[model samples]
Target: MEKPVHHFSELFEQLGLASDPDSIERFIQRNAPLPETMPLAEAPCWNEGQAEFLKEAVDEDADWAEVVDHLDASMHKAQ
Candidate 1:
C-alpha cells in the first residue's frame, strides 16, 4: 500500500484555519515561536477539535504528520 501524502495548507484547512499562503504566513507569525517545552497539541491557540487532530496526527504518525511537523517547526522558528 502507498503511504498517503499531505501539504501544509491542507493541514491548516483541516484545522479549520485560513489556508492561503499569506494567511498561513500570518498565522505562523501571530502564533509562532511555540516554546521549546510546549507540545503543538497543547498550544492554547487551538480549540478542542483542532488540538485533537494535531495530537492524533503526530501521535499516530498519520499522513498528516509530516505537514504537522512542518507546522510545528514553523511555529517554533524565530521571526
Candidate 2:
C-alpha cells in the first residue's frame, strides 16, 4: 500500500480550522514534519465546490457586514 502526502491546507481543513497559507506555514514550522505517506483512511479529502464557494464569497465587492449578519442569524437558527 502507498502512503499519503498531506499539505498543511488539508490538515487545517480536517481539523476545522483556518486553511490560509500563512496559518498552515506557521503550523508546519511549529510542529514536527508529517510523514510522506499515510493510510488512505487517514488522508484528507479535498472539495472543489467548497473552494469555489470561498473564492466567490471573497471576490464579491458587496458589503460583508450584511453577509456576516446573515451568517450570524443562520447560526442562531441552527442552534
Point to the candidate with the largest lDDT. Answer: 1
> For residues 1-79, could you state the per-residue lDDT of candidate 2 as single tens digits?
5435445455457446578988755644543232334322222332565433333443662233244233223323311
- List the candidates' TM-scores in order: 0.95, 0.29
Q: Which stretches of candidate 1 lie over 4 Å from their true place?
A: none
For candidate 1, what is the lDDT?
0.90
Cα RMSDs of all predictions? Answer: 0.8, 18.0
Each candidate: how many clashes?
0, 3
lDDT of 1 by residue, 42-74 (tens): 988999999999999899988898999999899
At residue 10, candidate 2 shows an lDDT of 57
In angstroms, give how far residue 59 of model 1 lies from its true place. Answer: 0.7
